[model samples]
Target: MTHFGIICPPVTGHLNPMIALGYELKQRGHSVSLLGWEQHREMVEATGIHFVPILSPRQAPQPDQKITSSRRMRLRHKLHRLKQRLQPVDHQAYTQSNGISALRIALAAYQHWSAIALRAAPAVIKAKGIDVLLVSETSYGGSTVAEYMGIPFITICVGIPRHQSSAVPPYMTSWPYQLALWARIRNRLTYAWLDILQRRILRLLNRYRRDWNLVPYTTLTDSASPLASLACLPKAFDFPVSLPHNFYFTGPYINDICRKPVTFPFDQLSDKPLIYASTGTLSNQASVYRCIAAACDGLDIQLVISLGGKGRDVALSNLPGNPLVVDYAPQIELLKRASLVITHAGLNTILESLAQGVPMVAIPGVLDQPGAAARLERSGAGKFIALKQLNAKRLRKLIQEVLQDPTYKDQARQAQAVIQQSGGVKHAAAIIEDVLDLAHISV
Candidate 1:
């Protein structure tokens, strides 16, 4: 049996997939150890995997009262949204919302992540332990640790495919360039900037590494093996990569492994089409909820609204003349039966919906959402409605048009077909095992 040490962010979005993969690996006789916040340790251990504690400060408290989806202090929102573009903004603000602490928490996470990897190195070397370190493309810890161990390491990208030069994940944007020259130029500039940032970050980490008990720098992502990593994303979306054949697409990993808490009372809906609504975890706008509620009011349809964790904030009244109001709905479950979806265009939500064959209305919030929303529009799977422009009238109108049209559904189905045929989790797992086999043979 091999022991694999993992370092992942403490957030639910990041940790879920990693946990799914680790659980699967454990079922196959391999042991996985995770280093993350103590808050999440119990959940990790519940999967029958070993968990190591990390010390990161707690994020500041949020507004004490429950807020309506679209309700916020107007003045505060204007200022906050303005800074969204200039992220890494005061980093302090990030704490209350995402449970981010001071810069030290981020630093602590890095240190904790690195230390776990470093400590695992002796186990790896002494036991001929891990065959290779498997890392989420977003997590720098395992890769850094791999460098120190001088062992083969692979990255498990959770998002869409991308080239080596990016400060964020590639799946955050839709890269369908009608103009090759423009696309190349964009990539080049993006690469240049990313390279500068990566180098800068590496410099900081390298200094902290020794003090934090980590090894020295390793090569950055390679064209050869740079990130010829494993991915839980499907093969259809994998596109043709510039990397080697060894790079893999593992079907959607660990996130789906858990039994979903969401459900829909299908019996309640009318015979008309279904529209699934969600603004994702970060931006669960009530505007979309109110608008969708209005749009479907008199129609013979079903509207399943997932307000992320803010359902109560949406204030469901007697009811939409045609829809059912639920605080949380199983997105994939509902989308499978949906004629249309209203979303915040988050990468995870959009990808999952696309995979389920549902067209969408993408209302992007901060971060990479706007970019993801634009791509959805480009893919013909959805249209973008900036949060600033979102309202009941506009949202209701958009829902009506999308529901009335067949073209959007067709496009969604086409994408879905690709996703369905892409040989999801099993396909992804096979690729990872293949990498392990190759690594075993090579070293």
Candidate 2:
């Protein structure tokens, strides 16, 4: 049995899928452990997987540290200002400026976390005697750690596909798929610009590689595992593009049976067609929720807004619609009953909605969400509006279009069929085992 070490960001969206994959591997008689911050120890251990604390005591956030908390608040405020600055007029200019701002913030965070991991991960992996590693695609530090130790690792694409292709637009933009030569040129130029922006991050990583006497990466994509790369995205939900031979689409790494039970007020739900709205576990802005409530105010549907555990500050009673607002809701259960979903175009939410045969109105805010939203519109499964362009009237119109038209639901069902056939955690596990076996043979 292979002992696997899982590495990913501590956020809910990334952690949930990686934890589910770890749980599946453990069920198959393999041992699995997650290396993360000490704060997430309880959350990881609760799933029956071992948790290895990676951050030094000094680096870890203290519960009573007012300074750390204040810093976080300030960062949140800065991000909010960036989002607010994105105007509907001059869409291209705003998209570029906002995208750059977001990327700068993300890279800064990653660089900080990666420095900690580089210092701590080698000792942790050695102590645990891990045989294989499963690193999240976004967790570049994990890949570096695996290489430093000369251990085999696989890349798990928990978010959108990050493979660079001239035919596909960058993941940060909501541009639709186009096959024209000019579209390819635009894609190439955007990619070059992104590479230039990421030069500092690349330099930081390469310095460590040179220190370790290992070959330095030329580009960010060079860090991905050559053995295998697994994505939770289904083929039908993605744009038609060629992927690397080692890459495999293994559907979503979801295990409902392994999830902790959540308490939801089912009786409060009305008989009218259900419209479930969420902005995922992060990016919970009160203004976005207000707009959603206003759009659904006079509609015939029953609206339920989930704050994703980040909306405690939002006053529910003051919202325009008397919608059922909760700090958190059992999303999968609600999706089963939902006639439509209004989402932030998060991959997990979109995949879950599709799995339930529910159409969506996507409002992509940041990161890979715009790419996922673009694919949603391209697939005919749903429609999307830029977050800057979102208003009560426009959102309500799209909501009506998705609900009144049967075509959206039909397309969702088609995607549902593909998801059902695509093996989830089990398939991913099998692929990991196969790659491990192949690596052993080569050795």
- Candidate number with greatest TM-score: 2
Q: What is the C-alpha RMSD of each candidate to the true structure, in Å?
A: 10.7, 7.9
lDDT of 2 by residue, 1-443 (tens): 88899988777788889999999999999999999877788778888999998864235332122225555465345434433432222323323343456566666556556655655677778878887889998777778878878789999999888878999899888898899999999999999998887776576667667655579999989879999999999977777889889999999888775566778999998899999998862233677888999999999999999987755555456888788988888889999999999998999999989988999999997788899999999888899998778899999999999999999999999999988899888999888988888778221
Candidate 1, position 358, lDDT: 84
* lDDT values, one for every candidate: 0.58, 0.81
Q: Estimate each model's TM-score.
A: 0.71, 0.89
* lDDT for model 2: 0.81
- In model 1, the runs with Cα more than 4 Å from the true position are 57-131, 162-176, 191-200, 208-227, 238-241, 254-257, 260-270, 291-299, 311-325, 366-368, 388-394, 441-443
Query: Cα RMSD for candidate 2?
Result: 7.9
